[model samples]
Every structure is written in C-alpha cells, then in structure tokens.
Target chain A: MMSVGELLSQFGDKYLQALWTTYGLTVLCFAGALVLGIAITVMRICPIKPLQWFGDFYVQIFRNIPGAALLIVLVYALPYLRVMLSYYMCVLVAVTLIPSSFCSEYLMAGMNTIGAGQIEAARSLGMTFFQIVKNVVLPQALRSTVLQMTNLLVATMLTTALASQVPLNPADLTGIVTYINTHAVGGITAFMISAFFYAVTAVVIGQIGNRIDKKVRILR
Target chain B: MNGAHASIRDVLYDAPGPKAKRRIAFVTVISLLALAALLAAIVRRFYVTGQLDPKYWSIFLRYTTWRFIGRGLLGTLQVAAASSVLAFAAGMLLMMARVCRYRVLNAIATFIIELSRGIPTLLFIYFFFLLAPQFGLQLPSFWRITLPVSISAMGVTAEALRSGVNAVPRGQTEAAVSLGMRSASVFFKIVFPQGFRYVIPTLISEMVIVFKDTTYAYVVNYADLMQNAKVLISNYDALLAVYLVVAVIYIVINYLINKLAATVERRTRAAVAAAK
Candidate 1:
C-alpha cells in the first residue's frame, strides 16, 4: 500500500493549480464586487430619487437571497435563460453579486458615520458637490470601510468553496478536497489535511484583517 | 436666557428635506424597474428557450418536491440550532478552561480559540464533516458529519465569551472570588450573566453565521434548503421562480433572527441599567 504522505505527494501538481485558480477567481470576483458596491452605495445616497430607490431595492433583494441560491441562480438558471456563460463566469457572477450587496450596505453604514458638519463645511467653502464628496466624505468612509471590507473579503474567500458545485470542478483547493474525499482511501486524514489548509488560509486572512482594523483605529 | 428658552417647541419627527424625498423616490423607482426587468427577462427566456416548463417548479412544489424542500428546511434549522447550542456550551467550557490558572489548561484553551479565530468558519465546518466520524460520533448523514466542526464553532463562540468576560472590567470576577464563592458558582452566577450581556451582539452575529453557513452542508449531500432548491432548479423549468422563493425564505428567517437578537440586546441593556 502507498504511504499516506507519498499518496499526497502524487497529487502535488493538481493541488498547486487548484490553489492558484481558487485565489485568482476569488480576487477578481471580489474586486468587481467592490466596484458594484461603490456604485450602488453612491446611487442610494444620490440627490436623485430614482437612483436611491434602485440602490435600496438592490440591497434588500440581494440581502434576502442566500449565497448558495444566488450561486445556483447565476450558474444553473442563467444558462437556462440562454445566457451561455462558461462555468467560471457563472461562479464569478454569483460571487461578485453577493459581495456587491454587502459592500453597498457597508459603504452606506460608513457614509452615515461621517459627521454632517464636514459636508456643510465643504459646502460653505464653495467646494463643488464632487469635491466635497471626494475630499470630505470619502476619506472618512474609507477609514471605517477598510476594516469592514477586509472582514467581508475573508468571509468571501471562505465561501468560495461553494464554487465547487460548478460542473467543471476546476482544480482549486475545494475541488481538490472533493476529489480527495471521493478518490482517496485515507478518509479522515484527507479531510483533516484539507481542513488544515483551509484553517491556515483563514488564519492568514484573520490576521491581515485584524492588522488593518487596528491600523485604521490608531489613525482615527 | 431662561426667558428666551421658555417656549421650547415639541417635535415628534424630523422631516426629511425635498432632496431626501427625491432621493428615496428615485432609488425606489430604479430598484423596482431593475427587479421587473430581471423578472421579465426570466419569463421571456423561459418561454423562448423551451428547455423546461416554467410550471415544472410549481408542480414540483405541490408534490414530492415539497416534502424534500420541507425536509431540507428542517435540516437547516437542525444544524443551526445544534451548532449554536453546541457553541454556547462549548464556549462556556473553554472560557472556564482559559480562566483555570493551570498552565496546561490555559494553554489548550488559548491555542484552540486563537486558532479558530484565525481560520475561516467555512473551512472549520468542512473539516469537521470529514473528521468527526473518526471520533466515534457517527452522526447521521443528515446531521452533517465531521466532529471538529462544532468544536471549532464552539471555539469561536467560546472566545467571544472570553472577551465578554474580560470586558466585565476585571473586578467583578475578583469580587466574586473574595466573597466566599466557589469558582463554579462565581462563573455561573456573577461572571456569566454579565459576560453574556456583553457578548449577546457577537453571539447573535455568530448565530447568523451559523444559519447562513448551514447552506454549505449542501455540498456534502446533507439536503439543506439550498441543496433542495438546486435539485428543484435542475428538476424543473420554473428556474427563476423557485430561486426567488428560496431567497425570500432566507430573508424572512434572517430578519427574524436579527429581530430576536435585538430583543435580547434590549433586555440585557435594561437589566444592566437596572443593576446600576
């Protein structure tokens, strides 16, 4: 019988590729979601009536939808609608949309926390609306948002495992995990190893988030 | 100054300005338009493509699929309830261990809480599903396997409680110890109540996490609502309708959870104030 470590060593190539794909897909989706988030938050706060309603509705709908259902809707439902996206694109849509909803809410929360006096000050100084938002509001929003964003990112990365449901089962950490569970015989050992890997990733994510939160608090 | 302030006006509500009104109206219109468009597109696509009947999901809902989804819903509640209670009890034990002053017990508790704090909660659950059976738990397939899953979860909740304990200002525990109270009594009576108040918000947040994360139980074929929804989507043609319904369910449950948490938070605050 092959030793457990030796058995694990054989799948190194597959494991490495899965790791890259997992991280790459996660970063791209999260970045896109952030843009969507910012747009929605801005619209919600806009002086224009229609834009604010659009933003509010978007948050309420997305917030209600479970992340898993959203994933399925994007992946399985869209194709049925004749939108022929590849599996990866489907996963991206689902992941990005969910985060966008959360990010918008977070941005709104951050914006609310900014003192109204700053905006009034900017207005009296004759700054244009854009200038006031850029100079006075954005900086404060960023301070609060940075920590919240980090927390969301960590959560998103963990949730990315749900992407394994895509038909392709791209060679990411989660995919590798499912593969090992089905193909390998070591049973709990395989599970433990994969979980350990995830736990390590989580630790790194948590540490990074905590540091940013601390830095922002110190700056304030 | 007294004469000038003599006639204070009574205010019931702050009136939003015209701009705020405009903003609200605009956002509402745009939002409805977008949702309507999404619904329309879904309907149109269903009509045109002909891959499956839009009525399949509705029919499914009326029959055996209904049972499956209902079962799945029960599963969702089961895992969430089990894990939350597990975390609470586990956390209490861990908190006790951390406070025990024995170096070994303290070390074990610290390591577990810190480790769990760093790891993603999803991975922790997945890990437990894989690892728990080895520990003789033999959880039914529906229980969502992996022994360490709840343990890790408990670890996080426990750590939250520890912080709650710390926030008790350090003197309360000391005061309890000096008043001829046993360690157990002091923990359950004096420290536990106060610590719970401080941690209630985080606890509620954790429950939300548990509720949402149970969806991950789908991957292992645990038949939670999410998995049931997916099976429904695949089995029928009313794809968007079924998915929409699923979304509403999550929102309703989550809203209730948040409301419950808020109620608890209020009671705690009232108690704190009353004590003061």
Candidate 2:
C-alpha cells in the first residue's frame, strides 16, 4: 500500500490536471445544456407544430442512444460531413446535446405545471408571446424544476468522463487513470485519488443543489 | 361574460391569419429544404469516400462478422444481466440495513451508498480493474466489469428501493408486526413486496441504464458491443457505418425496453385500481 504522501508526490500534478479538466468540462457542458435545453423546452411547448415535432424527435433520438455511443459517432462522423472540430469541441457538442434532451424534458414538465391562468394574465396584459415566456413562464418553470435540473447537471458531469475516449484530448480523469495505470507503479493508489476527487465533487454538488433548492423553492 | 371570451388557443397567439399561415408555411418549407440539403451533402461525402461502398458493408454479411457480433452481444448482455441482478439484491440488502433499527449498520449503509453514488461508474470500473491485478487476483476480465458495474449500480438501486419502501404506508408494517410476525417476516412478506410493486417500473428503467452502461467495459478491453465496434472500425476503416449500426442497435433495444416499462406501469396501475 502506497502512503498518502508518496501517492501525492508521484501523481499529484496529473490528478490535479484531471480534476481541473473534469470540472471545467462539467461547467461548460452544464451551461451549454441549459441554454439549449431552454430552447428545446420552448420549441416543444410553443404553438408551432413543426417546432414541437422537431423538439420531440430530437429528444426521442438523442435520449435513446447511450452517451458513449453518441460521443463515438460525433467524434468520427462529423469529419465525414466536412465539419471539422477539435476533440474537445466535439466532446463539448456531444455532451451538451445529449443531456439537453433530458433537461428539456424536465423543464417541459415544469412548464406544464404552470397555471394556464398565469399565461392568460400575461396575455391580458398585452404581453407578446416571447415576453410572456421570458418574463412569466421561465422563472416559475425553472424554480419548480431546480432539483431535477441539478440532477441532470450532475449526470452530465459524470458523462464528461466519456469524453476521455477521444484520443486527441484525453485530459479527463478517466483518461488520466488509464495513463497512470500504464506508467505509474502505484496505479491503484493514483486511481483511488482520482476517485476521491470525483466523489468529493459529487457530494459537494449535491449539497450545493440541496441548498439552492431550499432557497429557491416556491411557496405554495 | 356576455361576450364570447377568446378561446384558450387564441390567448397564446391569435390564430394565424391567412397571410400569416402562408408565411409560416413558406418558412417551414425553406428550413426543411436546408436540412435536406445538409443531409444530402453528408451522404455525398460518404459516397465519395467509398464509405458507402458495398464491399465495406459486405463485412457484415460474412460468417466471422456475425460470430464476432454474436459474441460481443452475448458478453454485453451477460454482464448487464448479472450486474443488474446482483445490484438489485445488494440494493435491497442495503436499503434494509439502512432502514433497520441498528444505528451503526444504518450509518455504514448510508456511507457506502453515498460513496458509491458519488463516484462515476467508469472510475469504479477503473479502480477495480487496476486493483485486482495488484492484489494477485487473476480474475477474468468479465468480473472486473461486472463487479464495478454492480457496485456502482447498487447505489442507485438502493436509493430507488429506499424511496419505494419509504412510500409504503407505515400502517401496513405495523399491522404485520401486531400479528406476532417476526421483523423479517413483516418486512419481507408485507412491506418489501408492496414496495417493490411500486418500484418495478423504476427498477426496469434502471436495468436499461445498466444495459447502456455495459459499454464502459470497453475501458477494460472487454469485448462488449462498443469494443467490438471499435475493433471493426479499425479493421474496416468504416467508422461511420460501424458506429451507426451500433447506435441503431442500442436505440432499438432501449426503445423496446421503454415500451415494455410503460406497458408494465400501466398494468400495475390498473391492477392497483382494481384491487381498490
């Protein structure tokens, strides 16, 4: 068994870099997914028939495929279409789009729970459709679905590990583990360190989400 | 109230006038055309690259290809099935332990659940894969994937089962105990069955998640579907075709599982209503 000090001295820098990549990718993906999710939610709920069908189709297709497979497809398939992107960018696009589908569903459920009277009131006030959605609907919808959205965020964070599969930019923790396993003497110790980082981050995120949930919860 | 109020449909937007309808139709058509053009360009690229070559796809028709796919599919299914069953049992045990009267056991269960849930599934697999060799455990590669998948899944499964058990009415358990039933009997005979009924749909969906997660076995060089597809991709250089087929298989399997879950859920609801 490697001592804790020995483990840190040997693999600390790589583990730290991996931690940074994991959190950085998580933040980027979460933000991108939120924006895309809101658009998808709007498309699904808006009065446009074509948009609604498109949103439904998007959710059905993306949500059904496993994230790892989807990542593989995007990484390999995009170049064929003459669309070039770095491995990081490819991962960004795939991770963002995949979880956005679920996030949109959760947001739509929240939107559905908003009273029709609220929309009616906004309409009576001569609010435009976009205005009503932006001002009146979105805030309430988000507030109600914060916990679900948080769950999606954490799941998305976890999926960032799949990005390590991309050979070009394999900086994520899982990728780092694979690297360490081959090169380092105490590979198990190094992996445990990475696991510890991930586990701690997950716990912290859950706690923060719980705190935000309590703060933002709508009063009945 | 005297005048006809606008219908709810009109509240969001006035029914599109004839001109507005025409404009919407034109925009939709243009967008569809653009999308079609993009897809055509993609197909054209494949055509030019020989990726659409019949020779490339012919590999799927060969006996060896089928054997490879069959073996990979079996491996994936075996891991998924074994992990799900083991995880379900472990989850139930953990949930039972968590809910038991013993404080220390409850704390230990909670710690395990949180630690397991907090760690990503891939990390668990990696940890076990690396750890096994160091400990001189000459286990098969399948155990490496199965053990980690099962352990990671246990966290989620236990959480689901815990919620299901908690949702059961307290009175049912109390009544079972009042009948001079032992604690285990009260739990197993009365509470667990009812709770599990409420959670069957969720458990089924969790199984689908486990099935999808079997792809992570690729990390350990396990010959699951994804790993097999990777090998084929390298061998044939038909990356797009190989991935597309893999994605389609996954989508079809998941779609079927979802439909099954929905049907089971409806049947369970109907059964409950009938019992009432």
Q: What RMSD does each model have against the real structure?
A: 6.0, 4.5
TM-score of 1: 0.80
Interface DockQ of candidate 1:
0.35
What TM-score goes with each of the models? 0.80, 0.89
lDDT of 1 by residue, A1-220 (tens): 3355765797667666777777887798789888898788666655554565667778766765667667767776666667878878777777788888888777666766655666666666867545666676666776778867876786667666666667555556666666766676545655556556666776677678778777775243
Backbone clashes, each candidate: 18, 0
lDDT (Cα atoms) of all candidates against the true structure: 0.69, 0.80
Give the alpha carbon lDDT tens digit for every residue of A85-113 in model 2.
Answer: 88888888888888898888777667666
Name model 2 segments beyond 4 Å from true: A80-82, A120-128, A167-170, B1-26, B48-50, B58-67, B178-180, B270-276
* 10 residues in a row with least lDDT, candidate 2 chain B: B1-10
